[model samples]
Target chain A: MEFGPHLLLATLEGLVQASVLTLTALGLSLVFGVMRVVNVAHGEFYMLGAVLAWFVTSMIGGSAAIGFMAALIIAPLLVGLLAALADWLVLRRIDYDPERTIVATIGLLYIIQQVTLMTYGPDAHPVAPPFNTRLALPWFEFTDGGLSMYWPWGLSTTSYKLFVIAAAIVTLLALWMLMAKSKLGLILRATQLDGETAQAFGIPVEKVYALVFGMGAALAALGAVLVVPIQQAHYLMGDDPLLLSFIVVIIGGLGSLRGTVVAAILIGMSDGIISVFFTPTLAKILATLLVAMVLVYRPNGLFGAKPA
Target chain B: MKSKTLLSAAPTRRNVLTGLAAAGAATALPNFARYAHAGSDAPIKIGFQVHRTGIGAAYGRWYERTTNAAAKVINDAGGINGRPIGIVAEDDGTDPKRGAEVLEKFANQHGCDIAYGTLFSHVVIGSAPRAAELKLPYFVVSEGHHVASGMLNRYTLQPGITDVKSQVQAMAPFVADNLGKKVTMIYPDFAFGHNHRDFFSEAIAAQGGEVIAKLAIPPTETSFTKYFPQIPRETEVIYHVMVGPSVLTFVKELGEFFGPSHPEIFGFIDSLEAVDFASPGLEFLEGTHFWEGMPRYAQSNQTDADKFYRAAIGIDDKGASLDDPKDVSTYAHMFGCWETLYTIKDGMEASGYKGPADRQSLIEAVEAITDMPEGREHPQGAKLFNGKTHQVFGPQYISKVEGGKLVVQHTTSIEDGLYPDEVDYTAQSF
Candidate 1:
């Protein structure tokens, strides 16, 4: 009822949104950073992840916890493999031409969407969280003897939501470490720096591209699996995530991973808070306008490198 | 005597050519020739404009199934006017622009006498003008009040399914008396949603209840927790009706936000139409009530007509297929398509329709229908068609979710929903 509790609840909701957005946008950013390709179907990949999560969970009948755990481990791997296969079959055939790849990915979007629709049907499905504990949050008030914590009546959040935030933080840290301190990351960075030179030095450029593409999609799938319990899996659910990921990628700098994470946080928080306070349409309007302003002022994005 | 002599004396080339042309024209027109009955034996074509690939695709799939099943029965039962009924289906993709194009295809390309089976309100609103322009005699199964509101032309009719105005009017009394006085409606933000907002507001007011908060959510929204905080704390009942592809999320999130401590929830079956109630996240809805246009689970007092319809559609008493429990039918809304096809057959028979030339007569005949009693012709319920508004009034069912099945608890009579005529389609002329 009070402003502080409402604001805190809004912030918690925003954090969950930001966590998913960060993972999804990071994938979009990574693909562009190393591959210099705009995957218009990135959102479809996100959707496919959710659908696959539902499928995998349904196939392996058990308690909700086992199903969800299996989905967490398996859905992203399966999605990543599929993305890699698509890269090899479709993107490789096009030679990854920048303009043509955009069109190709758009086609892939529809193909993937229709396939899911045919297989999964046109209904929204809900996945149960592994655990859902209603935890009442406490608000602190200044009393005669320092500050004391009191139970905030009607102001609480679920444990699953908090878990989402923590999980995202852990995932982000792991991703950062993988990109910054691993051999695969080294080859990936080399390809990003100079594909021709990397190929000449036997970096296996094509394979790296395939790997990056798969990893990018897998990251999106990972986000989807995390959020599917909170949201429903529908064939058309990918559009928003795709749009927001592109917005985050653009504003953060198209090829800047760190920038992408920062931008996702900003957009996700604002979207959640604004949507709660005002209207979802207005929140989207403001985000789009923000993108326009960013493009006008800093076209390279916040952390994008200066062109040589 | 002079004209007869002149006509009879003609064995000339001009006379021969004129006679041959007249014979060809008569054969083509069906009703003009002395051999008209022979030519009229050809199948009567009805265009089914279906939303096979968009937001309404779920409903469209079931509507198509119902249409085919009804057509098969009609054709087997000696057909209408002793001619087989043929359904020429075109996918509208659930987009308005595509819906209009489908209607044009029906009129000009397919030569169908009528176009029917559009479900979503926007598509109906979008395609109705084109139907008017083409004089296609559009029969929409959508629940929107657009037809009764007099926004569309006279050629369009909704004589099988009850409109949103009538449905909400019938529901308001039950919601006020049984549920609570202060209501908050969370509906899809579109024309259909607007109808619920406007009509329910007025209807509830007449029942001495007030709508405390109205939340209009975008139909495409994926998540809904952020929207729940906006419901005023004093709200006593949460009235929700969500459509499109994400209804499961809409319901599940509401449950999560409330967690068994929220207001009494009453939802339209739209939110759970295709969803299995036993699905894990939906257990929170065990005791809540939902408004069903037609009860999903067959009742103990189920009519012979409803049983026949279910068997024909391969659905069991639980509204799922005999094969798979997950393959649930949209029982609430799809009966409109079945009933509408029968109505079209009745109209065609009443008009003595022989061909395209009798299209106007068909429209007039349909307008002439005053009552449709519940039977094999209408499995949903009995309906009273108002020729003035081109809308039907029917009984609405309130079903409670018990043990993962929707059980019918109340059925409102047709008169409870009737209101003053908004517009007379008959007065506007065909």
Candidate 2:
């Protein structure tokens, strides 16, 4: 098929985009599951991580590698703590109305975006890519003009994409372990299942809830820190992922970890596929509609019900 | 000093108010002309529709500051063809609907002579129709090409850079020659980003290159994984049109994968800041290139303006140089107010109209200004208006962000000024 390279590359693109999508959306799910509240300001958390990476590594006189690494460790942790404080200071007082909580998070989104704009200005940031090395897939050689691909391989993509794929896997695994194996993980799951019951069983549900919320926010920051080399930091950069993550979580079933992951992959792949075959705007419309249909069919989401 | 004062004399419109009726175009719509000045029995109220928030706030706030300063200067001089000027300032908060309400009050009830200032393109789009309906001359600082490219506008004039066409024309060819191997385009799926995409693709293609892919992610999208698959290893350049944290996130993720060895990548420095590249582990940008609307302020001109503005208004001159040879778009925004106000004085003097709040005299004189005078104090030399188009034509420059500062590398000849037209005048309902 003449379109073989396009199809193969499209599939590859889907997997790559899926990696970041899953990591970012997974963070949302864990927080929502544990706290029973959606932190809509999650995108802002991502924005902060990018800004931190940009400033720490590029602005100060230091090794970019070391500085960026330092930012990765510290920025996300700070974001987590800030998220915890927000939960304590603002949302904690009014979790009764989920609608109000949504409004509150929207306000938080505005606050963070404006603060970032005031501090950073409204410009696109170009973070230095990791190694800038290029490894052709040995199948397709791209000339200054057009493209040609060899047998079976049929297409060439960047080797760094593999890094993204690997990172996503590692993050998902680590998160899975934290959820399934650790003490906090167990407490979080118990709280997710039944907060009052978990509190009765002496799990300290409230403390676990706050910690869980903070950790999810940390994941967002982690995603931000990791991706700064790929895209760049900007103030309004969080709205897209915020919207897509909503679609992903709704399709996967809110509060369902495995479902979020699976749904993220599906959403990512669908996006890539749509961009490949149709136009970007059409693809978005389709993906959004797909989420709507899924919601109509399964209000609890595809995998959202509590496991019996 | 007396001779210097004579040499420094500019065109002045002294006490020339209440004379548009002599021209008798007031007779064309005398009744509405009466409505235009319905409550002007008192001092004329001038309102500012400005962005105190969003990306445009930085310049918008500055524009309002300078406008107020200039208006004050005029009042002290003699008060406009000769009524006193009164200003009513409202914050649009950088939102379009809010901008519309602010304009509605200025036009419908407050009876302003002219409503000026807007930062964001979308917000300008949002407020333009309402301003047009009220027949208020809306001077916006937005650079959206749609504003001047035959849209719904009779009253909205954009004196700044045309962000899309000008940036693309200046930079895309250089990018095609320097880093045209494999280019990827990624931007927010908003109007601003979309404009970049359309122009970048056109410019790149005109240079005999093809855009392998154009990625339009939703607003506030931070993840790069899903988008990375489309970025083939063969990509030699990336055209990033994102803002805020996404810039950092995108660059960081790109770095984690490709590091400094990914081909040459460029971004719109105007849409961002010098700090983003210099401070944020953007070593890849060490020899990086960028397109900006402001050139490095020269010491001589900056010192001159500083001395003059400070001597006149007693405010610190925390502004760019009048002689900075940057692109004209932003220069127009930054310095256009000073020029327009000064130009109005000249026009009123030439046409024998007056101000302070001489609304009729100022509008008639401004509408009649065809050629600018000699040795006038304008940032980009002088500004001439196309009376037919009601837009100003000025110069644009090419720039590169070097050593964390913007330096002008080249410039384009003066082109026509643009105003939003009639088809797309709806700046509301956003």
lDDT tens digits, residue span B1-430, model 1 = 3343326764667678888999998777522123334476777878899878778877888898889988898888999999887788888988999999999988887677788889999999999999989988999999999999999998999988999999999999999999899999999999999999999999999999999999999888888888887788888889999988778878877887777577788999998877778766677888889999998998889899999999988899889878887888889999999899888888988999888888888889988999999998899989999878889899999988888888888899999999998787788866
Taking all chains together, each candidate's TM-score versus the true structure is: 0.91, 0.69
| Best-fitting candidate, scored by lDDT | 1
- Candidate 2: where are CA atoms >4 Å away? A1-13, A51-61, A89-137, A140-165, A306-308, B1-46, B55-95, B105-112, B119-122, B142-154, B157-333, B345-360, B373-376, B396-430
- By summed lDDT, the worst window of 10 consecutive residues in model 2 chain B runs over B321-330
Per-residue lDDT tens digits for candidate 1, residues A1-308, read: 56677778788888999999999999999999999999998999999999989998888878889999999989999999999999999998999899999999999999999999888977677778889877767888889999998864446677888888899999999988988999987988999999999999999888999999999999999999999988878888899999999999989999898899999999999998898888988889999998999899999888788788
Residue B188 lDDT in candidate 1: 94
* lDDT of each candidate versus the true structure: 0.88, 0.64
How far residue A191's Cα lies from its native spot in candidate 1, in Å, is 1.8
Give lDDT tens digits, candidate 2, residues A1-308.
23555677677878877887787898898888777777789888888877877777765535656776687788888888988888888887885257888889889998988889888866555555455444434355567778975543224445556677887899899888987899877878888888889989988765676687788888888877776666767677677778888889989999899999999999888888777665556768988898888878888889989446
**What 10-residue stretch in candidate 1 chain A is worst by lDDT?**
A150-159
Candidate 2 deviates by what RMSD? 13.1
